[model samples]
Target: MTIPQQSGTFVLVISTGGTIACTTDPATGARTPTLSGEDLVRACGTTEEVRVFDAVSLDSSAMTLADVDTLVELAGKALGDANIAGIVITHGTDSMAETALALDLVHDDPRPVVLTGAQLPADHPSADGPANLNRAISLAADPLARGQGVMVTFGGDTFAARALIKRDTAERRAFALTAPLTVPRPAPAARAALAGIDVPILRAWPGADASLVDHVVAAGPDGIVVEALGSGNVSTAMGEALGRALDAGIPVVVSTSVPFGEVSFDYGGAGGGASLGARGALPSGWLRAGQARIALATALATGTDPRLLLGV
Candidate 1:
C-alpha cells in the first residue's frame, strides 16, 4: 500500500531490528536482523521523502533498558528538526511495550512516536513487514497523531503505548488495544545510571516457598516485583521474604499474574496485599508483571515516589 504524501511533511523511520527485518539462514534456519532503515523505507513504495536512521540490530529479548536510552537520545535530536513531523520505530514485538513505555517517560516532545513490526520474518512467503511498515509510516505522517504520546500501529490498528499488549505468538493481528491510554502528565524521568540497573520478578504459586525470594533479596537487587495470585495475594513464606526485602530498603511492587484485572490491597493476612502494603509494599494498579518490572526500575532510578508509576 502506498501512503499519500503530504505537501511538505515527512516522517523519520528508525529501524532497530526484529522479525520485520530478519532474513533466515538456509543452512541453520536461523533468522537474524539484516535490513537497514533505508532498506525498509525503500520497500514502502511511497513517493513521500521519508528520512531513515539505523539504530541497532538485535532481537527484543536481548534488549536492555540501557538500549532504550539510546533511542530516546536519538529521538531528542528530532525535537529541534522542523523537517520531521513524527517518528516511527521498527522493533521486535517481544519487548516493544517495555521499550515504548521507557521511551514515553522522557518523550517531552509533541510529535508522536509510533512502533510497529511483523510476526513473520522478511524472507517468509507471507511476511507482513511491508504492510506494517507502510501503515506505521502513514500514521507517523498524519497530523492527527500529534500529542498522543508514544503509540503502536500494527495489523491495521493503533493503540496508545501504555495499552499495547502482544497476546498472540504468530497471529497477524496479535496486538490488541482499541482505546488510547491518557496520562494526566508525562512520565517522570530517571537518572541515566539507574536505567541499566537490574530488577527481578518473582511469581506466587501454590505452596510457594521463600527460597527464591530469599536468594534474590540476599543479592540486594535494585528492586523486585511479585506476580501474585488473585487480587495480588501471596503465600505466607513468600510474603515474609518480600517483607524482609522491603525492610532492607529494596522497593517491592505487587502485581497480579492474571491478565485482565488490576491489583489491589484487598486481603488482610500475612500473604495478602493489605499486609504487604502495611509493610511498605506498593500495589501495581493496572500494570502486569512485564510493564511493572520496567516501571519499578524507573521508579527506583528517580527521586519520585514509586506509587505514581504504578497507575499507568
Candidate 2:
C-alpha cells in the first residue's frame, strides 16, 4: 500500500517503527516491518477521507532526537492545515514516554496528537495493533482531546504525556500514569489553562551510566535523573560519577529502574542507593525515570534551581 495522493481529514500517521509494522512469515513465522504506511491505512478499513504518511521506517529503538525534531516539524505542519483533523504517532513503547514529553513541551498546536503502539506483532492472532490504532485515531479526532498536550491511549484510558510510563513489556495495556488523575477544565477555557502548563526535558536518558551523569553536571544542568539499578541504586562507578555531577553545580535525582515502586534510600553507604540521598541527591519516591525526567524538565523550564528542588 502507498500513501494516498491527496489529503482529506488526514490523520497524518507518522510511523516511527514498532511491532505495528511487523508481520509473520507464512513458513518461518518471522516478524518484520513487512507492512508499510499504506498497508496500515488499508488495514484500518477507514474511509479514503483519512490519509497516512510514511514519515519514517526505522524501529522505535532507533528513534533519536533528530527523529523527534522531524516529528515535531511534521505535526506542526499538519496542525496548521484546517483539513487535518489530528496526528497519530506509532512508536516503540520503550522510549514513547520520553518522546511524548518532548513533543508536549515544544508542540504548541491545539489539535490532538495521540501516540499509540503494540507489544505484539500485528500478525499475531491476539494482536493489539488494530485496537490501539483505532482508539488513537478516535482520540485524535476528538475535539475533547485538543489542547490536552500529547496523550497515550491504551486499555481504554487516556494518559497525560507527563504522567505516562511504560509499565509492562508484553501486556497490551502497557501505558500507566505515575501521577494522580488531573482533570482539566472544560474546553475553550481549558486550552488557556493548558497553555500555562510548563513541561521541560532537562535530559533524556536512553540508558544509565555515570559518565552521562558527569557530562550533564559538567555542562551545568540544573537537574538530572539517574536511571538507577533495582530499586533506585547505582553502581559504585555511577554513584561516584553522580557525586562529580553534583559537585559541578548539577542536582541529581535517583529514579527506580522498576517503573512501579517506592524508591528507598535506606541502604546508605558506599556503592548503595541511600548514599545518593545522603550525597544531596533527591529520591523520587514512586516516580519512574520517565516521570522524573518530565517533572525535572518542567521545573527547569520554569526556572527552578536543582539545589532548591532537591532540598540541598
Candidate 3:
C-alpha cells in the first residue's frame, strides 16, 4: 500500500494518534495508539519531504475540546508560516468529523488541510493505514486540493469536512459526508468560548417521552439537538418537552435519524417538524445528529442564532 515518493512540494503530516497509529498491547491484548508520527511517515514510504509530528496520542472517543483547540492552534501555525503545499492530519475515525469541522470553521486558507486515518491497527497484517495515509499525503500536495476547505481522505473518497458521519462501525470506508446547512457562515468564536459549552443530542424512539429533554433542560445546557424519527417527527410529549427547553431559553435543533435527505417541516402536528418549527425548534437540514450538535455548539459559542445557520 506504500506509495513511492515523487518530487513535489512538501506536505506536513500531523499525527494525532488513531487506529492508524495503534498497535497491540501485548500485556492487555488491547490495541492502543503506540506508533508515533514518524512511524506513520515511514510507513507511507514517501520521500516528498513530509515533515511529520504529533499533537496527541489518545483514543479519539476520549478527545476533548482542549485537544481540538491544540490542533486548531497547530493548523493556524502551519497556515501562517509553512511553505508546504498541504497538511495531512492522522486522526481516529471515531471523532474525525468533529475535529475536521472545527478546523473547517476556522479555516480560510487555500492550502488543503486534509484529515485521514485507518480502521485497522498499524500492526495488523492487512492494515489500511499506509494506503489511506499515502492517498492523503498525495491529496494534500495536489494543487487541485487547494481551497477545498478542510477535507478527509479515507477509503478512496475525498470529502469536505462539513457534517461528516461515521456510517459504518468496522468498515474501512466508514465515514459519510453530510451536506452543510450553508456553504459559508459566521466565523467561529474565540477558543475560550468553546470551553464549558455543552450541546447534547437526544434521539427520538418508540414510547420515548420528554424525560430525556426535561433532564437535559434541567442541567441548563447551551443548546440541544433532537434526532427525530422519519423526517423529523417526535411524540407529542417530547414536543412539549422541547417547548419547555425553549422556554428555558435554550435553542433546539431538529435533525433526522434517516441516513439521507434533508429535514423538512412539511408535517404539522404537536410533534411534527412543522409544529417544532412553529414552537421555536429549528430544523437541521442535511445535518445528522452528531454534526448537528457541533453546529449548535458553534452557534451558541459565537452567539449566532442557530436558526440562521441550521434552519432548513
Candidate achieving the largest lDDT: 3
How far out, in Å, is residue 250 in model 3?
0.1
Error of 1 at 256 (Å): 2.2
- Model 2 Cα lDDT, one tens digit per residue, 1-312: 233345456676777777887887899977666677667656766543566777777667676656665776677767777887788888777788877766765557788788887788878888777778878888888778887878887756678775468877887788886545542311111011112332222332334456665655656655677667666677676677777766775656777666555667877554467787778777755556665664455445545543332222
lDDT of each: 0.80, 0.66, 0.82
Per-residue error for 149 in candidate 2, Å, reads 1.1
Candidate 2: list runs displaced more than 4 Å. 1-8, 25-29, 182-224, 229-241, 261-287, 291-312
Local distance difference test, candidate 1:
0.80
Report the Cα lDDT for candidate 2: 0.66
TM-score of each: 0.91, 0.71, 0.91
Worst ten in a row by lDDT for model 1: 177-186
TM-score of 1: 0.91
lDDT of 3 by residue, 179-269 (tens): 5333453344444336578888899986678889899999988888999998889988998899889888898999988887778887887
193: Cα error in model 3, Å: 4.3
